[model samples]
Target chain A: MAINWFKYSSPASFYSLAGKMIPLFAAAAVILLIMGLYIGFFIAPTDFQQGEAYRIIFIHVPAAWMSMFLYVVMACWAGFGLAFNTRLSSMMATAIAPTGAMFTFLALWTGSLWGKPMWGTWWVWDARLTSELILLFLYIGFMSLQAAIDDPRRADKAGAIIALVGVVNIPIIYFSVQWWNTLHQGASVSVNQAPAMASTMLMGMLIMVFASWMYSIAVILKRVRIIILERESHTTWVAELQKDGVA
Target chain B: MKPRHKKLAMIVAGVAALGVASVLVLDAFQSNLVFFFTPTQVAAKEVPIGKSFRIGGLVTEGSVQREDTSTTVYFSVTDTSHTIPVVYTGILPDLFKEGKGVVAQGKMSDRGIFKADEVLAKHDENYMPPEAAEALERAAKAQKASLSE
Candidate 1:
């Protein structure tokens, strides 16, 4: 009898599917990023005053946006796992943790580089910067907590609770400039209002954001496949796949 | 109750409480979050004098002056259209240079000079820390290429 596809949520089925999706997403990520970079650097018009220093926005803003976005995504998966007792969901959250942390680190590091030229400082304890730093720590804490624990199920539950609590910071990070007299600038592109920047610059930034989103999906999918393999090593499906030369 | 489960619960609660406390503390101090404004913004009277804040722009050419003590440096930050003079005393970041982006945190004096408590030098994306010379070279090349094109 053929097994139901949805039952593959049992880890064995999701593993094969994740493996199939990784290469496709990776190819899309590479293509979109290269195209986005070309438009950002070569084709975009230079700022009248800031000149090339403004180019840093293409990478900085997108990475910053993605860092926050990926955290929320991780939290959602964790929440689902906690609520439904779904093993696949928690594994997906675990898979996304490292990449999310990397993006957060990248955002902070690149923001510092951009900030030095624009703000004249390598670092500050300002609202936006401070909150972002906290996000990084949260990511680290989640990963460490998961690794330090011997039992995977207990680790997932603990990590899920932490992730849920960390969600409070996400809104604070996004609204820091508006809610407080922050050192950081207000939003340049709001959902309801027109963008403060030139059209070309906005286009470039948006394209880069899409590219980053694609890249995250690609990396997370790849990581999820490895996680499934390790977690399901004792399963009969894994044994069958290995015997079939498909592992 | 299992001892192990109790310990895990306590740890999780402790972390969550810490996170909540920090957010509250940060929120309480939110009023002090001052951001740097460009010389153009200052010129437009967007920044109030005698109010502690930050000002950021490029160091105007030939505007840097060193006090006899060698620790104090005075310079004007400009965005071509506007200029704000700044006074700072301390070892500046290695990346700080003339005609480069700078942000100084302090109050604008009655005399219109920005008296800075701190100064920060901005670096490029490709730059690694503690290597100002290489970043300078790259900046120069980028500027030259942009101007030529």
Candidate 2:
């Protein structure tokens, strides 16, 4: 009966809640990442054809998935901010953009490394790669657009519209493997088929995915706190938090 | 019932609609993106000519012919047993040579020659830029030694 979702919609309340959640997610992320790496590198069988080079998949695929997933989540937050005019939602969207871009770059870098040994090319303008590059550009564009605007509210509205428009590219990136003649391979693991990889490899990838998810949450929470402090600097709670040296 | 909240509702609805539309469009266009085939796959009569695609494999020994600005390179991509011949005209990557893996993007010609528009030299993950020159030097020395023998 005491539950009030709207009460926590205020930046101060959400900041405190996010602060508490960060440590837990960070710890989980570290543990899952270690386990994932151990299984992927040491326990998984070497690919019969690609030999040792195929091990890059454990990192590459998860990073790629996270890149796409984080974009969608950011767009969702941007949408929430635009529709509800929630200060916290826009802050969340802003916080997530850099991390999403980082993962997208990591995925492309690792994929190039993987491709060189297996496909005999360091780069290909295949559907998946091209669309992913576009996704990176979209992230950069959104961030730059927000930074270029002086008014915070206007920035948020502009960013939300861009994010919404760019949302169309996410699905295109995801299904590029299936839609076009790309050098990139098809999905090795899908819900419809048994994974083409060993159980250990599959487990490693899943664990890494979970780790990435937790890591994103922790990073976003930390970033959201900073945004709250900057935006609500004049508020009494912020003043008190600053006095306590917490903000 | 506040004006802000009402505006928020409209934006959320717009995003959802866009998300749905993208999923449908992507699903509809999911088949035309494939552009690469292994030599073995092509050998099995699996590749359709006049369609753009890619071929990946090692540069065949003694198949590189460089003429001033333009170079003619021939390579064979093999998935173990099957090998496809790829012919390319362009500047080969500095690291490109015999037994080195390379991928060329283009379409197969009617003459059964794999005509490439772009050539990419594949290097190992542990590659150092300086190592390419060293590799080329070592290869030349080994070839010279073999001829003298």
Best by lDDT: 1
Q: Fraction of native Cα contacts kept in each candidate?
A: 0.18, 0.21
For candidate 2, give the lDDT of residue A3.
90
After superposing candidate 2 on the true structure, give the runs of residues whose Cα lies further than 4 Å from its correct spot. Answer: A1-3, B1-112, B115-149
Cα-lDDT of candidate 2:
0.80
Per-residue C-alpha lDDT of model 1 across residues A149-180, encoded as one tens digit per residue: 88889999999999999999999899887665
Cα TM-score per model: 0.70, 0.71
Predicted structure with the largest TM-score when compared to the true one = 2
Candidate 2 structure quality by residue, lDDT tens digits, B1-149: 79999999999999999999989867866643345667877787777768877776667666665555556766666556776677777666555667666667888887788888887764432211234446767999999999999
- Please report, as a residue range, the 10-residue window in candidate 1 chain A with the lowest summed lDDT: A177-186
Candidate 2, A46-94: lDDT as tens digits: 6434556677877898899999999999999999999989888898899
* TM-score (C-alpha, index-matched) for candidate 2: 0.71
Candidates 1 onward: DockQ, in order: 0.12, 0.12
